[model samples]
Target: MGVGEQLVTYVTQNGYYIWEEFYRHFLMAAYGVLFASIVAIPIGILISRYGRLSKWVLSFGSIIQTIPALGFMALLMVTLGLGTTTVITTLFFYSLLPIIQNTYVGMKSVDQTVIEAAHASGMTRFQLLRKVELPLAVSVIMAGIRTALVVGIGIVAIGTFVGAGGLGAIIVRGTNATDGTAIILAGAVPTALMAIIADLIMGMIERRLNPANKASAASQ
Candidate 1:
């Protein structure tokens, strides 16, 4: 059969299953992102506030990023066993560096004058952060989140190798079957599409969150 014919047949046979697998992958990735965000954001905020700790936190997170994803997955499988737990844990760890670093940088990047103004107006530290710093930092923080989501989505596919079901199964199956085309299309296509869609959505959200910048840009 021609490549086109094979592709048609494969899609016809597994379209629903593929979609189901994609959704499962998406959910797993989302879980990983959420978990990382919860942990990373607070740590980032604290690190930024402390200043002394920011260096250590960034260094530690960078070390984690240096560990290969597959190697990390292997280590996790030994402790957590092969399942959603392992996948989520690995993905969460992988996602930490970008989110944490970006959050810290974002918060720290807030204008000093703006912060002083807030404090002069009798704003508490929390109030200064919430009303002044966080709002200004939203774009950078969201940029980190967008990066995490995209990276996490692609890496989550590796979970299938450890028995966390997702679109990775199709790609793995196709590889074992010696159907290179199937593996490529099944894995590469969806992952790329998901990343693009996620970036676009997150970009919109980041823009919406930065109303001042949005307004200024609109006026220009």
Candidate 2:
């Protein structure tokens, strides 16, 4: 059979397996971003409160971001060993910079006049952050999260190296085969599709959350 036929046949036969791997791949990416958000968001907020700390904290995250993906994963493997844990841990580190940076920027972006007004109304610092700053900054924060997630999906594909099964495993299998272009495509195609779909979904959410977009919609 031709390469196209071979690809079709493979996909047709292994649809269930591919679906399972796709689901697994997505979850691994999602978990990494989610965990990063929980920690990074708080740190972002704290750093925003203490301006002096922002430089050191963000620089540290930037240093982590500079590490090569595979090298970072390999370093983690020394302690984490193999499996989803190592992959997820690597992804979590990878996700930190964008999230924390965006959160800081978002918090900083809030209008000082608004803050002063809130304070005049007797709102506590905590109350101001919770009620005013956060709502205003949520879209920017989501943009960071969206970036992290899209990037994580690509990184998670590398997790197969550490025995964290995902579509990358299939691609690896293709590499082993004598004429595995079809098999490679079977894996690569799905991964690309997953990334595209994820980006689109996250982009929609970002746009919806944007204050300008809301105002435009209301005006319309």
Candidate 3:
């Protein structure tokens, strides 16, 4: 078939395949983000509360961030074998640095006076975190999530190498077929779209969650 005809056929035949690919990776990415957030947020809060550990945790997470994605994936594949479990695990680890760093930074960046006021108001530690600190830190935390989502979407293509099917499968097929253009467009297009959509959605969540935004809107 001609290239145009081929493109049309591929899209029509594999639209669901593309969506499935996107969804699988997207879900995996979400899991990774959630895992990272769960691990990071509490640690971040602890560091913020203690002040002394902030530097150490931030430094440690930064070190993790320096480990390349492919390197980590390779190591996991060697130890865990190729599959969804391995891919998800790899993505989760890759996600940690940003989430932890951002959560720590976000919580630390919360205004001292706000925290002091919360304490003066008889807010317990949990109450202060839930009411004052977390709400204030949401934006920065969201920023980290955004970064992880985008990075995860792209990195998920690597899962193809480890037998975790996704859009990466298309790229892999195109590669084996020696179709450079197919590989490029097939992999690049959907991943970019997914990342863009994910970021926009997270941004909306961040805006909605931001107390300052809500207060301003209330005033307006």
Regions of model 2 farther than 4 Å from truth: none
Q: After superposition, how far is residue 26 of candidate 2 from its true place, in Å?
A: 0.5
lDDT per residue, candidate 3, 152-209, as tens digits?
A: 8888888888888877887777777754564456666888888899989988988887
Query: Which ranges of candidate 1 are over 4 A from the true structure?
Result: 217-220
Clashes of each: 0, 0, 0
Candidate 2 structure quality by residue, lDDT tens digits, 17-42: 99999999999999999999999999
CA RMSD of all predictions = 1.7, 1.1, 1.8
TM-score per model over all chains: 0.94, 0.96, 0.91
**By the TM-score metric, which is better: model 1 or model 2?**
2
The residue pairs that clash in candidate 1, if any, are: none
Model 1 gets an lDDT of 0.86
Pairs of residues clashing in candidate 2: none
Candidate 2 C-alpha error for residue 120, in Å: 1.1
lDDT of each model, Cα atoms only?
A: 0.86, 0.94, 0.80
Positional deviation of residue 90's Cα in model 3 after best superposition, in angstroms: 1.5
Off by over 4 Å in 3: 1-4
